[model samples]
Target: MLGAALVAKKASELGLQVKPWVKTSLAPGSGVVTKYLLKSGLQKYFDQQGDLDETVASAIAENDIVAAAVLSGNRNFEGRVHPLTRANYLASPPLVVAYALAGTVDIDFDKEPIGTGKDGKSVVQSSVLPDMFKSTYESITKGNPTWNELSVPDSKLYSWDPNSTYIHDPPYFKGMTMDPPGAKRVKDAYCLLNFGDSITTDHISPAGSIHKDSPAANTFLSVGWIRKDFNSYGSRRGNDEVMARGTFANIRIVNKLLNGEVGPKTVHIPTGEKLYVFDAATRYKADGHDTIVLAGAEYGSGSSRDWAAKGPMLLGVKAVIAKSFERIHRSNLVGMGIVPLCFKAGEDADTLGLTGHERYTIDLPSSISEIKPGQDVTVTTDNGKSFTCTVRFDTEVELEYFNHGGILHYVIRNLSKQ
Candidate 1:
């Protein structure tokens, strides 16, 4: 709610009209925060006359883009993205509204454009973002304000109960036996990869249209969902059953050397047979064999969607040996109990001559304390080819998330218990 109000306030101040779709009830903190900000003269530039929905609808009608500024942890507006929006840039709320009003990502601070205000005045876009952030931060952190005083009630905010049955629980291993030392080694090592550049999260977990005639569409159809019922991949994230099937379903993917088989890359070991990406994954999982994914630089870029990591977890990918990783995806990988190992300096998927044929083993323990960032882990294939890669757990927070099995699990165990 604070985020919404901030966007509304920013839009009004910039003379850009807003029409908000009030999806959830506004919380007391939102009203309190907004009213306090307004009383403190932070929102004085924004006009206070319009209704939220009307402003949002008007803005959407008038503008070419409809972007959402959502927090990563909040699930309230999870399924809000529609087919109409051209580009959905997800970031913190202030950034979303600022980017929307500016109408472009390439905003030049030195020569910013000015929008005409309703009061027959010129308003500069440059002043909108920085000022709002500064004031909002100060009001929320330093100023002690009540929700009722600000006209925001608790009933207006969306409520997310951590105990909700819809959320998946972390995997439990109450009576499982641990693998004995040296028993986890694999003989054949095949590097399943492609020579590519700039593999963003959109490529990993596409947010665009899913054609019903495609391989992924056929899989969905096989599972009883009709073409029209096939929603965007982003909408079906909560269900791992659907996510695993849909991961790597992006049509733009081209496994150049894999006999032109696109989408997810598939490789057969020993017999040297080939199959669809997901089918191969299912085969490996069925045989109780571990798998790894090798890729070029910037392997996971774009939106901070957690499903990118979760999809690989469901597919039985033990690790992603990438030349580089985007910030959020790296954390998301660890959150899902997957190892994200980076190639040694000046070495990559291409240099190693990985043929995606070797069986691989990751010695990650189910326990968190046993793993440390920057530790060298050995990788050996069936043909006796071996290499040691450095493990990275860059932050303590990431380690904690990994230790607890993921963010959702951590939240449920900590906050929900209270």
Candidate 2:
């Protein structure tokens, strides 16, 4: 993944000092990326930028700096990138080099120069894509389709172990409805999560190893799945029991509902008790209080993780009110029938004094047919205050899908009619 490690390297080469506060990390999707990074001479630059050296607390003796992670991979969501790093940017190898030199993304590449040339004139050099052997890439994929030609099991009715940890038949569709256009207002939803900018899909759909003490782990533990077989959330995705519990289970998320407490936590307002995020969600569902997420700019700003939306949907989150949203995340939310709302400029939960204790009511059109792009929706807070927001649905297709409570549900209804 295009990550902090690479950007740090670029910064080092240009004599730019990455602010020690900027949390940096290198989380490539695979080791092959590392091989090419070394082959392309980019790894040395990463090493130069931020050494696996001093801690932020240690670097505090020097300067209070913000950590910025640059990665080639696409997963740059909030807590998923790393707990310490607040800003994560996805960039090409060349842009990483430029940002490393510039030490920020707040630059006008067209108007501002990155660095000076040795000759004393403006150095306008852009990095070229490194060359790779076509044959090398071709050889790797040569036998992929040939392998798929292997025979399938004879029986159409596949056998299920029922107790398999890696796979399970999800019960989501067991009692599923195939209705159309059930759009409804988000009424009195609780703010399950409140955070600053750049919340990624990784933070939403955590793929890392399941924690032994997490709600997901507890379910497996209760089910007799030993800690050793408790495989990752990614591995247990087929099981709704695991995935539903695993939702919001990211250990790195610093949910404000927990008063700066780290890892899956929230405050169940009715009970005035703090609990793990999943447990809190269960309580809220039992209490019949719908949930909402309040966030700063770029909510859902990392990888296009679908579970980020699905997890919250399962948790009964009816809406997400954010200053802004990463495009793909906004779409994914709608694809799951979750209302994505944007705060009016200069407004957020903090500015309104919403301490995640306030009840929320969202006003929208009664049906998808009446809604239009960039439509205004009213949000009323508990203090008898109200503000208007723009609906985040950017397309008719998204609106239609959302009305039916998600793309799959919409497809099911349409197909049933056909």
Candidate 3:
């Protein structure tokens, strides 16, 4: 915090300011911290950078040009910050100010000036107290007016509002059964998506802004919600209808099925129709056909977002066949009852001579008890091509979870027996 104050002081003295293109703002931890900064006579300097509400209101418009975000926070993963910020960097608070002033990360403070001086010439140059803390701590337990004003119902069992678009009961266990359904193979499955290397969870999951015409946004609009009122996929996660329609909906996804075109689109194998990934998956489900994803190495590499797994399961993805898988996401796929398979070493879709336009069949054991972790499974394509994949169960517990259709079903059935 002191670093930010010093930067502000130095920038003011040099007549340098944050770039207008760069969105500048401060989200301090609490009002008390702001109060202390105010008491220290540094708030005025901070205000010069426009630390207000509007700058952080919503994500910037999507563009082909690369955008970046430098933050003092630790979670600087790919899509965690904002959809438009393709690259995220971690820096000290003062360094954040430096980058913000420069409006770009491509600079060296040792030789380059952060910004041009007031005369439009390039230049190169490079907090808390404890006293009022007691009073702030006294009221910390009581939330602010908005939080306190929330009307929570008083009941043992929570009432689910059927009309709510924000929060609704998920359908994971809607038709669950106590008895296991014994293992079955995925036969005649269509390739829903064909992806290449480094396909992160960000690419697989629904995230960031809800596009104006996205399926999630349409679902909201159908129920009387306006475009601006449709919060992000992260906010509407409680509603399965919205999330299921958003699977594989990343704006930047590159499906090989589209032949180098970007965005969340795929070829519906049966009809040769180019549809959104979710729309293709829905049509496959309606036609009583299971679907599988084909991908290259390091698939599911980014954040271990549960929605990445949950959304695929809801989309009727029976299996995912890739050259390799990220450890946590592999486990998550099993927990959601979607089989994760890896191609044999040195073999991928490119080498196996298989295009994504083939009908696939995964030959699994007849019963759950016969399946073992890391066992070799045979996958065949309709074009007379076949390959071997390593089943990614990894443990007996995971096998049981898949046997019961998902981890939630496994837990619920066990609890009922008790």
Best candidate, lDDT: 3
Q: Which of the two candidates, 1 or 2, achieves a greater TM-score against the reference?
A: 2
What TM-score against the true fold does each predicted structure earn? 0.54, 0.66, 0.85
lDDT of candidate 2 at residue 173, scale 0 to 100: 52
Error of 1 at 252 (Å): 1.2
Off by over 4 Å in 3: 5-17, 24-63, 75-79, 115-127, 131-155
TM for candidate 1 is 0.54
Model 2's C-alpha root-mean-square deviation from the true structure amounts to 8.3
* Candidate 1 structure quality by residue, lDDT tens digits, 285-309: 7876677777778878777776677
Among the numbered candidates, top TM-score falls to 3
What lDDT does the true structure give each of the candidates?
0.56, 0.71, 0.82
Candidate 3, residue 70: Cα displacement in angstroms equals 2.4
For residues 293-392, write the lDDT of model 2, one tens digit per residue: 8888888876678888888888889899899999988998998889998988998878877777888899887766888878998889777878888888
Better of 1 and 2 by lDDT: 2
- In the range 1-418, model 3's lDDT, one tens digit per residue, is 6556667767888888777667666768777768766766667777854321334333343236567889887677565555556688998987888888787899999899654324211111113456567778877899899999988989987788998887888888787667987576899999999888999888888886787677777777887888778877888888888888888887668898899987778999888999988888989999899999999999998789999999999999999999999999999999999999999999999899778999999999989988999999999988899889999999999999988888888888899889
Q: After superposition, how far is residue 197 of candidate 3 from its true place, in Å?
A: 1.3
